[model samples]
Target chain A: MKGFLRQDGRKGIRNITAVVYLVECAHHVAREIVFPFRDQQVHLIGFPGCYPNSYAYRMVRQLCTHPNVGAALLVSLGCEGFNRAALLEEIRASGRPADAIVIQQEGGTRKTIAEGHRWIRAALEQLAATPTTEMGVSDLIIGTVCGGSDATSGITANPAVGRAFDRLIAEGAGAIFEETGELIGCEAIMAARAARPELAPELLACVDKAARYYTALGHGSFAPGNAEGGLTTQEEKSMGAYCKSGNSPIDGILKPGDVPDRGGLYLLDVVPDGEVRWGFPNISDVQEIGELIACGSHITLFTTGRGSVVGSAISPVIKICANPETYRRLSDDMDINAGKILEGEATLEEVGNEIYAKILAVAAGAQTASEALGHQECSIVYKSFEPTGPACMPA
Target chain B: MNTSSPQLLRLHEADNVLTVLSTLEPGDALHLGQTVLTVGKRLPIGHKVAARPIAAGEKICKYGVPIGSAVCAIAEGEHVHTHNIKSDYLPTFERENQHSYFQPTP
Candidate 1:
């Protein structure tokens, strides 16, 4: 595929113009502006909180300049706490078209939304004229996250995604698997799989922080559906969830907004450091997806046993159904029926290859089941992080 | 291995529990290799059943990893889930069992 080349030398599969509401007040205007342009790739994302959070600033900056995104429209409610100027400068520095609309100055909601439509259309036309460069599996970055996990997830979709990750890494592409809380008991095994021996301790310490954080919240990462699906403990779920990384050696660790400089298989550590002053590390699966995009993931593989129908704003989300029954119940939401492995209808390798092909297909502009169904779910939350440990980013 | 269509999925060879692929009723016979268990109770699909007699306080194994510890003796063919097994990580909160705020049902 000919990937859309960015000024930063990164390649992107999708050339999207992100219309981001700076705060909750401008969300309506942003949504209305993107409504008429069904033919163009315009996604709406926003930080809804009124508070000025450093985390939100970094997240919005990262999203605006993400490899998948070509340009960004900052919709400010005029007096919001977000640093709109910094974000605008970052977008402009990326050599991408950007426009800002302040609701107060632009004649309020009705007039502003009309003007935003013109700006987005002009940006879309400009992006369409942008040049694209040759891209392959090696030039792509992929991430996997398991949601609505049931018993079949570990044996089917997660392992299949892992297999895909293994193949992607072997081909010199970047692969990422996240949720440190979900990787509780597998630290030792994961550490042992680190590319270097020294990376082992850093791997262990990250999970330790996750364990402590979740313990303070009076919960493990395990959900009620997990228990019903026969997952007994957090560690047990970790063993299952860890398979999404395949058997590749860990390369480096990345906090929420850090893109991998050199990637093999990175653990996207979403857990906040220093103190757990923030509420939850991630509010939902969409937040995790958002972070993956912020870290420059081009395509995300979402494996679900209970069926998650979410597709992200910028990057494409390919849903893999892990349970046959759940697949039957929610086939419309699924892109790949990995549940076939459990039914003996398909092999794990077959599903893995299918996912790999699906990724390439999506990268080449094939709409996933979620995208085809118009499920543009995007989320971002505020959380502080004490910069990653030195070992977190391997040399 | 069962001569007929298999009813269970074993993730690991060392696992003491076999995940039921289909619901198994009492008196139904399930054969796995040389071992067999006459279902003592209804085992729902996707749920686990003890493959052998499990001692109290013994680790519950699935995917050849310790999922949790059993709180009571679980005979072969008994259901293995939250009822008897408990996680070694955070305690699975049972609101009704807490003395601080849990009120006894009248």
Candidate 2:
């Protein structure tokens, strides 16, 4: 199938209007810019920092220039240090249209709000009028994350997601599964499955980096309730979590917002890129979704054994239920019943197909369970990273 | 309840514990291989029950791997939780108090 070709030669699954806040100070202006559009594809995204840093700048630049985004309006406070010019240059380099408006320069709040709204409306009109071509499974990059997991997660939904991912990879789609802190114990096993045997060194280095990062931060990603739900160690949780990758050979590692160079299964190193600073890579469900969106995921498959109802601002989330009880209790929020495998109602293949079908439908413009319910839960945390240790990467 | 369908359940042959898809109450007849036994307590959905007697400090298995160790001797069909089991591996996070908090009642 064909796809909507962008100026940068990248194909996009969705044409979006992104209202960007240059700093925390400009959030209101950016949000107001998106308010008039009111289209689900028009989203609000920003960094809350007034002081500029490389990580923040890099993340903002990637997000603004994401293929899914057709155009962007950068809202800035005239006195902030966010470097709006550099960001606009990055977007312009991608050949995507981006406009930066400074609140202080545009007269004041009331006047800037009026000008920002007008600018976004004009951008949206041009964006909406852009012609779109048909897209194929191979052209899609999808990501998966499991939150509020339990024992049933490993037995059903997570593996069923794995199956769907395997099918996607077979169809040449790029798939990413992340959270190395959760995969602590399964590093060696995962390393063996890398597409490039040498890539195994990079794989272990990623997980080890996560372990060291979390250790330095005074917390492991593991929750106390994980033990109550029959999980004993971080490795046990890792084993269950790792199943979401299916059996596809891991291609390579990409930091948040870095697009995959090839189509296959890839591990997203969600841990921060610098020393142990900021906080965790993600503070909640939507932050990861935001990162995936920045990385150019057209959709996200979310597995939950304990039940999570959050969605993202830019992409649709298909929530796959991993536990029979959780499915029963939160059927309204679930798109696939993977728990049926354990209850003997359906096979893994059947559930996997159900999830894959849901992906197609979502891509075709059908609202997911989370989308229909309007659950736009988003968050981002801070973390500083030190480079990977030699043993952490694949051998 | 139909306890006759234990054969339908696939307990990882290498695992020391088995997960019950349905709830099991105390005194219910349970069939495990050639061994016939009665449930010792009511196990909730998604909870694990020891398939066989496990001695103190012995590794408790799940999914064919040692998830943790038994803190005390546990009878078959007993509910396995923090009180009866403790993780054998050190956690990745720093802890000020290094002692286990699990204590089995009887």
Candidate 3:
């Protein structure tokens, strides 16, 4: 497959120019700047917090210089606590065409929007001249997240994704699965699959931390619709969600923005390290998708039984439906009908191979159902975490 | 499609509950191990049915693991849901008493 090669040697399936708003105050202007280019590969992403956060800073920096991003235009209100200067410097260091527009310094909204338009137009031209390189399966990093889960999710889509993940890892591609808060009861089994014996405690500890954090908040990641769809308990829901990891040995633990250095299976710990300072770890599925993108996932495999129609800004999302009734009702929003396994129309291996084939097709520039429907949802919220321990990623 | 195909699926041999493959109405006959049982109420697709007689506080097994415990004694072919089961880890959320699924133990 052909891919957009960055100066840092990372390959991306999609080369997009991102317009980032450093603060909530600059969001309107950033949106207006990307409005005219919305039909193209330009997208608007931002952090809404007025206060500074280390997690948000790292996330924004990683996103601005993501392999999928060709260039970036930072929109700052000029007074927010976010370190826009450092962010711009990091993007520039990555060899991407980077520029920043401070609204306070460049007059008000009108002038700043106009300047952003000019910079983005020029950046697009430079990106058009960027070189392309041949990419292999090993160059790809795939992530999986299950949203709107039901009982069928575990029986069909989730396990199918696990099959696809195993295949990707065997072919030398990096695969990541997350939502530690949802994997409450499966920690023991998951820990047993760690690549090294020392990494077992790290895996178990993260899940234990998630259980404690959620108990403090008086909620697990269990949603109302989950119970509505025949999922009786958090652990039951977790068992289904855990199947998305496949049976691959865990390579390492990753916080939101920590990119894996090698090709293997990694678990993204979405739960914050410290006490629950932020209201919730992730407010929506889009936030998790953003975190996965920041970790260099070129494409996300989103499995759903209740039907979530969200797609990210930088990367495309392939929606696999688990329930046949839901699939029949929302077929247009779904890419693969994994419900066939339950209906006796297909086997898990067949659907898994189909998902694996779809990943290659999307990497080669095929639009997923959500992408073709113009879904570019994104979000980043306040959160904090300490760095991973030495044994978290054993060599 | 085979019209006579069993609609109830037992995911694992040790699982005490079977998943409903398609919606079944009251009085629909279900072929359990060596015995035929009739559905007493409407069971929707993806819902669970007790594979055998289960006592109160017995672990509700699915995927060969305990998802929760039975809140009340459940007969074979009975619907197993929030009304009859409780999570061992966390409380399941329901919308402002809108659904009759969960009943507080008095």
Candidate 4:
């Protein structure tokens, strides 16, 4: 397959020009700036918090310089705590065309919006000249997350995604599965799959941390819809969600912005480190998608039993519907009918191969159902985390 | 696909619960090994039913792993859910505006 090669030597399947709003005050201006280019690859992404956060800053920096991004326009409200200058400089240093427009300094909303349009016009021209290079399976980094889960999720879609992940790892690709809060009961089983023996305790510790964090908050990741869909408890739901990880040996643990150095299966720890200061680890599925994209995932496999129509701003999301009835009702929004496995129409391996093929097709420029339907959802919330320990990433 | 496919699926040999592959109503026959049992209640697709008698406080196994523990004695072929089982880890969050179609037993 072919990909857009960045100056940092990283390759991206998409070369999108991102219009970023640094604070909630600049969100309208950023949206207006990208409104005219809605049909194009220009996407709007931003952090709504006026309070500066290291996690948010690092996430924005990584996203702006993501391999999928060709150019970026930073719209700041001038007084917001986010460091606009540092972020702009970082993006520029990555050899990508980047500019920052502070609303307070640029007169007002109208003036800044006008300036953003002109900058985007020039950047789009520059991005059109980005060089393409040969991209192999080894160059791909894929992530998986299961949302709207039910009993069928474990039986069909999640395990099917696990199969696809296994195949991807064998072909030398980086695979990531997250939501440590949902993996409550599977810690021992998951830790046993760690690449190195030292990584096992670290894995166990992270899940324990997630459990403690949720316990303090009085809510696990379990949702009302999950219980209504027949899941009895958090651990029951966790076992279903854990099937998305497949059977690969855990290579490492990654924070939101930590990109994998080599091709292997990595677990993304979405829970905060110190305390549960932030409301929920991830308020919505979109937040997890954003975190995955920040870690440089080119494509995300989303398994849903009840149904989820969300797609991310940077990378394409392939929705795999696990419930046959739900699939029948929402077929237009689903890319793969993994529910066929439950209905005896298809086998797990067959559906897995189909998913693997769909990933390559999406990377080679095929729009997923979510993308075709214009589902470019983006969200970033305040979070905090300490760096991974030495044992977190074993060689 | 066959229209008369099996309505219930036993995921693991050690599992005490069987997943309903299709909505089962009272009197629907469930084939389990050498014997056939009748559904005792209206259970929706994706819900779980007890494959055998489960005593109170016993671990509820699914996928060959303990998902939770039964809170009360459950008879074979009876519906198994939050009303009868509780998480061994954290509490499951339930929204106040829960759907009224299925009410939890007090």
Leading candidate by DockQ: 3
The superposed Cα distance between candidate 4 and the true structure at residue A253, in angstroms, equals 0.5
Model 1 lDDT per residue over B1-106, tens place: 1212378877887888888876678899877557776877676666888888999999998877888899999987678888889888766544333464244556
Taking the tens digit of each residue's C-alpha lDDT, what string does model 2 give over A1-395? 44456788777666777788877788877777777675547878888877776666766777777766788888988888788888898898898888888988898778888998888778878886766777888888899998887777877888899999999999989898988888887888889998776789888888888888877765566665565565656666777898899998887777776677668888888887657666766776677777776677888999988888888766678899988887899999998888878777888889999988888877777788887776655444444444434333334
Q: At residue A117, what lDDT does model 1 achieve?
A: 85
**Clash list (residue pairs), candidate 3:** none
Two-way DockQ contest, 1 vs 4, winner: 4
Model 2's alpha-carbon lDDT is: 0.76
Model 1, position A357: C-alpha lDDT score: 94
User: What is candidate 1's lDDT per residue for A86-170, written digit by digit as tens?
Assistant: 8898899888888799999999999998899889878888888878999988888898899988777888899999989999999
Over A1-395, each residue of candidate 4 has an lDDT whose tens digit, in order, gives 99999999999999899999999989999999999987789999999999999999999998999999999999999999999988988999999999999899999989999999999899888989999999999999999999999888988899899999999999999999999999999999999998999999999999999999999877789888898788999888999999899998999999999999899999999999897797899999999999999999999999999999999898999999999989999999999999888778998899999999999999999999999998889999989999878888756
- Per-model CA lDDT versus the true structure: 0.85, 0.76, 0.91, 0.91
TM-score of 4: 0.96
Q: After superposition, how far is residue B43 of candidate 1 from its true place, in Å?
A: 2.7
> Which lDDT value does model 3 have at A72?
93
Q: Rank the candidates by lDDT, best first.
A: 4, 3, 1, 2
Q: What TM-score against the true fold does each predicted structure earn?
A: 0.95, 0.89, 0.97, 0.96
lDDT of 3 by residue, A122-148 (tens): 988899988999999999999999999
Question: Which stretch of 10 consecutive residues in model 3 chain A shows the poorest summed lDDT?
Answer: A386-395
